[model samples]
Target: MFGIHDLALFVVSGLLLNLMPGPDSLLIMTRSATQGWRAGSAATLGIASGTFVHILGAALGLSAVLAASATAFTVVKLVGAAYILYMAIGLLRSKAQDGVQAPLALAPLPYRKIYAQGFLTNVLNPKVALFFLAFVPQFIDANAPHKALAFIILGCIFNINGTLWCHALALFTGAASRRVKLHPAASLWLKRTTGGLFIWLGVKLALAKQN
Candidate 1:
């Protein structure tokens, strides 16, 4: 049976993992800085909701196939890469039109679209699915009598930890962005940098080896 100690360990691991700064974190930061805390928070919720999807898929053994099949992994990775590249392009275009001096305002995006963006950003990443498959199982001790319950408990803990840390980051960065709103040039450069990072990550992920 899972206990509080296990929960503590899981939370610690999750928090540390969140601090490591991956694609999801970068996405949250970019959206938060470019938009606002509300948008960023929406994206975070989307990501958390996406994690639940992964958990369900993993529980159903769909993620195992994703891990095992190189073709499937590549296909999903390419799709994610494409999406990231598309975002980069959008940023570049926006910068060109806005002359890098425009104030960062929350774009008039529908709430559902914002949420879906977050969900798809996470769900599209094959690496995330693979990570869940590889990471979640280790906490389930073979000796534990209720393996399913243990997996679910640990997964939920991880999701909650991730959401909390990401929300904190969004709040911090969103607030800072407000102070720097006048520096459109700076925002432009930041967008370029963010775009570059996303593109690079997409390329790296595309070239990653399947486990």
Candidate 2:
């Protein structure tokens, strides 16, 4: 259903977005570094699950509604921004206790909670929904047969590419975190940087226009 140009564009776009240090990537790194590979991988799975919801929305035309309705877009954006700010506050508070020499291990959070957190983090971001709405359409050939199927195929490709890339990042960061487990100062700085990134992205997302 996809042409060579379409596949190339999807891969290039996905890679660029994956490389961008957004809230999702920052969250994955923070969780991995703090909790280890298991937690990081779990969070990565959660993020992937969330992307599926976006894909579903795109498929069902809900994303088009979100693109059209300012009120709906604003509501989702506010929720996402608030959530990121909350995460930032938690990280900042942890920084205050940086003197403690606690080993970095994944706290025993419920699996469902971890999964839901990851899912909601991405699902609630209006920008992501709108992006897919605008982005996927560009690759679709209006004159082609089975256009809907074409979009769905491309969406799955994007999701798979994104999941693999992010998972690799989580694994690598988790390994690095193991080596630096004893360095509380370094961990503290990493957490602070992560928290800052989330807050900054949240603010930028909140301020984004509907265009």
Candidate 3:
């Protein structure tokens, strides 16, 4: 069991991290703003599922390989960047129509595909593996009876915090779905903006050095 102080700090830190805007959050927002609450929720769940993989990687020392091997890190990073860029291009090419009913204008794609997109987006980023390797260990107590168990617990806390925030954002976007629906131009701009963000993120990821 972690000390009460450590546990409290972990929760606070986890909450703060989840609040910080990043690719994961952006993906959820884009899906919500452009699609609907259901799509956004699916993306959020997929991202959370990917977090579990990173946590397990960290626990099993697999993340350390990513941290230590520049080649592996670069390979994963480039692949993630490429995938994100592909998504951006798709968004950019989407035709906007007049009288579009906002978020619901486009027929909802299968939730399974959206989920896979979110999951792949998260899992392919080596930076996430590195993040877990660096971030989670800071709160781990060397004197703890079961370090691995503590890691798992703390990682779960991080995932839960993130999921709550993702859902909150999705619901907020859902509430605005009707309003966005009323403005066709606004919907087009939303897609473009989201697409641009993805482009920037892809470039950022491509340039990132292993940390």
Which lDDT tens digits does candidate 2 get at residues 15-113?
655554556766676677777667767877888888878877775673445535546644654665666667667666664345334234556576567
Candidate 1 at 209: error in angstroms? 30
- Which portions of model 3 show Cα errors greater than 4 Å? 2-5, 62-108, 178-211
Model 3 C-alpha lDDT per residue in residues 13-39, reported as the tens digit of each score = 466556545577667766787788888
TM-score attained by model 2: 0.61
Query: What are the lDDT figures for the candidates, one per model?
Result: 0.64, 0.64, 0.67
lDDT top scorer:
3
TM-score of each: 0.60, 0.61, 0.61
* Residue-level error in angstroms, candidate 3, position 209: 30
Taking all chains together, the TM-score of candidate 1 against the true structure is 0.60
Clash pairs for candidate 3: none
lDDT of candidate 2 vs native?
A: 0.64
What clash pairs does model 1 have?
A: 100-184
Ranking by TM-score: 3, 2, 1
Candidate 3 global lDDT: 0.67
Local error of candidate 2 at residue 7 (angstroms): 1.8
How many backbone clashes are present in model 3? 0
